[model samples]
Target: MSSLLPRLHALWTKETLALLRDRHGLAALFVMPVIFILVMTMALHDAFMPGASIDVAYAVVDLDNSPQSQALVRRLDKSGSFRRIAVGQDLDAARQGIRENQYALVLGLPAKFGERLLAPAGADGQPTEPLTLLVDPTLNPALQLAFRNQTAAALGTIRADELTRRAGKLFGLPVSPAAERDWPDEIVSIAVQNQRSIRPPSSVQQNVPAWLVFAMFFVVIPIASIFIIERQEGTLQRLRAIGLPFGHILAGKLLPFFVVNQLQAVLMVLVGMFIVPMLGGEALHMPAGRSLIHWWLVAASVSLAAVAFALLVASLTRTSQQAVVVGGVGNILMGAVGGIMVPKFMMPAAMQRLAEWSPMAWGLDGFHTVMLRQGGFDAILPDLLKLLTFAALSLTAAVWLNRSSQP
Candidate 1:
C-alpha cells in the first residue's frame, strides 16, 4: 500500500506537468466552455430574460366594438406586454397576420363580448365568454403559453371591473369602491400549457445547466487525443516499464484531466453568473438554501463522469485521428441526444424518453436540481448515482482495454 501511494503520486505529478506544458490545450479546457456558454447564452439571452420590456409583437382584433371591448384593447396596450401592431375589425386578417409570422399573438374578442360580460354564469359551470388567444406557431411553445397566461391575468384583473359594472347596470346597485381592491379566490385556466418539467420560470435557468453539461462532456477530445499521442510515441511503453500497477497509471492519466475539466465547469458557471448579464442577459437566479459545496460536489461528480467517457474513447482508438473523430463526433452527438443542444422539454416525447440514457442528461439533471430547483443532496442523489454508475462502468472498460493493449 505504501509503495502504491508513491506510484500514484508520481504518476499524477507527471501527468499534471505534461498537461500544463501544452499551454494551448490547457487554455482550451477552460476557454472553450467560457466561450460557448457566454456566446450561446448571449445569443438566446433576450428569449430567456425578456426583462421588463415585452418584445413579442402582437395584434388585436376587437370584433365587439362595444365599450368593454375597446376598454380591453386599451388595457392591453397600456400593459406593454403586447404592442398594438394591427387593430382591425376583421378577424380573418388577424389570423392571416399570425400565419405570416408577423405577430406573436392575436387577441380576438368575440361578437357580443359586451353582452356576455353583462350576464351571469349559466346553468353549466363554464365560461360562455372565453377569450381566444391566437398565437403564432413559429414562436416557442413555452413562450406562447407564457403570453397566454399574462393576457389571462390581465383579463382576470379587469374581470372584477366588468362584473361591478354589470351588477350596477342589472340591479341598479353599485359595488363599494373599497371592495374592488381585493381579488376573490379563483382559478384562471387558459389553453395550450407549457412549463418546465424542471419547472423553471424562465429560459436562462434551464439553458445554463444544460450547456454546462455539454461543456463537461466536451473534454473528451483533448483527453482522448493526449492518450492517443502518448500511446503512438511509445511513451505508454516507457511508463509501463516503470512497473506501476495498471490502476495507479490509469489514475495518473485520469486525475489531471479530471481536475482540468472541473476547473472548466467552474469557469463556465462563473461566466453564467457574471458575464451573461453584462450583455443584456439575466444573471442565473439561485434557488433558496443553495450552497457552494453543493455546486462543487455535483461539478466534481460530473467531471469524473466526463473523464470516464474520455478514457473509454482513448482506450478504443488506434490513432490520434481516430481519437479525434470518435471523441469529437461522439461528444456532439451525445450532447444533442442528452438535451444539451435542444431542450428535452422542447423535443418530441419519444426523444425525451430516449434521452434518459445519456450521461450528459444525468449530469444536467443533477446540476439543474441543485442550481435551479433548490434540490439538496437527497434530491439530486438519483441523478448523481446514475452518473457515477456510468463513470464506473466506462472506467472499468477503459482499464480492461488499456491493459490488454499493453506489452
Candidate 2:
C-alpha cells in the first residue's frame, strides 16, 4: 500500500507540472468558461423572465375606426408585454412596414368591427370579417403565438365589457362605462420548493453551473495532450518498467485532473457570486448548509466523469492532434446534447430526451437539484448515480484500451 501511494504521488506531481506549463490549455480550461458565462448571462437576461417586457414592436391598422376597436388597442397597450408602434390606418402601409422591417407584426381590424363586436355568427344574416394578423417571416414562431394570444385576450375583454353595458341597461342596474375593473387573472410565476418560495431561475443561475460543467469536461484537452505525448515519448513504458500497474497510472492522472475540475468549480462559483453581479447581472445563489454539501457531491461526481471520459479519449487516440480533435469535438457534442450550451427546458421534447444520455446533463441536473430546487442529498442521488456510473464505464474502457495497445 505504501509503495502504491508513493508511485501515485509521483504520477500526480508529473501531471500537475505538465498542466501548469500549458498556458493555452489552462486558458481554455479556465478563461473560456468565464467569458461564456458573462456573455451568455447578459445576452439572455430577460429571456428567462416571465413578465419581462418583450422588445418586439407591433403596429395596428384600425379599419373600423370604432370605439370598440380603439378600446381593444388600448387594452393591448395596457398589457405592457409588447411595444406598440404608431402606423397609418392604411393596411398597405402596415404591410409595407413589415416588409421594410419597421415592425414584426401588424394587426388589422376589419371594417364594422365595433358594430359586429357583440354580434354572433348569422345573427345579422351577414358574415363578420375576422381580424387579420400579418407577421414578418423572420419573427420567432413562439413570439408570434404570444402576440396572437395577447390580442385575443384583449378582444375578449372588450366583448365582455360591451355585454355587461347592454345587460346593465336592460336590467336598470347602474354601471360606469369608463370605470374598468382590474381582473384577477394576471399570471404570476412561483417556483415550487420545500422551503419558502424562491424566484424563478435567472440567466446567470442557469449559465454559471452550465458553463462550469462544460469547462470541467474540457480537462479532456490537457489530459489527452499529456497522455499522447507520454505514449510517443515512451514515458508509459518507463513507468511500467518500475512495476507501476496500469491502474496506478490511471489513478495518478485522475486525481490531479479531478482536483483541477474542483478548482474550476470554485472559480466558476466565485465568478457567478461576485464577478457576474459587478457586470450588472444577478448574483448567483448557491445552496447553503447541507444543501451545499450536496452541491459539492454533484461537483465531485462530475469531475470523476469528466476525467474518466478524457482518459478514455486519450487512450483511444494515438497522436496529440487526434486526441485534441476527438476530445474537443466530443466535449462540444456532449455539451450541445446536454444542457450546457442550451438549457434543457428550452429544448424540444425529443432533444430533452436525448440529453438524458449525456454525462454533462446529469451533472447539470444535479446542480440544479441543489441550487434551484434546494433539494437534499436524496433529490440529487439519481443524477449523482448517473454521473458515477458513466465515470466507471469510461475508466474501465480507458484501462482496457491501454492494455490492448501494449506491445
Q: What is the RMSD of candidate 1?
A: 6.4
Candidates' TM-scores? 0.72, 0.93
Count: clashes, candidate 2: 0
Model 2, poorest ten-residue lDDT window?
177-186
Whole-model alpha-carbon lDDT for candidate 2: 0.91
| Model 2 ranges with Cα > 4 A deviation | 1-6
- For model 2, how does the per-residue alpha-carbon lDDT over 1-407 read when each residue is reduced to its tens digit? 54777788788999999999999789989999999999999999988888889999999999998778888988998999999987468999899999998899999999999899998878889998899999998999999999999999988888888888878989999988754556665788999988788888899999999999999999999999998898899988987886778888888888999899999999999999999899999999988888889999999999999999999999999898898899999999999999888899999999999999999999999999888988888899999999999999999999899888887
Q: Candidate 1, overall lDDT?
A: 0.73
- Tell me how far the alpha carbon of residue 40 in candidate 2 is from the true structure, in angstroms, after superposition: 1.9
Model 1 lDDT per residue over 219-332, tens place: 776777778877889887786777656677678877777777777766766677787887676777654455456766777788888889888998999887888789778888
The TM-score obtained by model 2 is 0.93
Candidate maximizing TM-score: 2
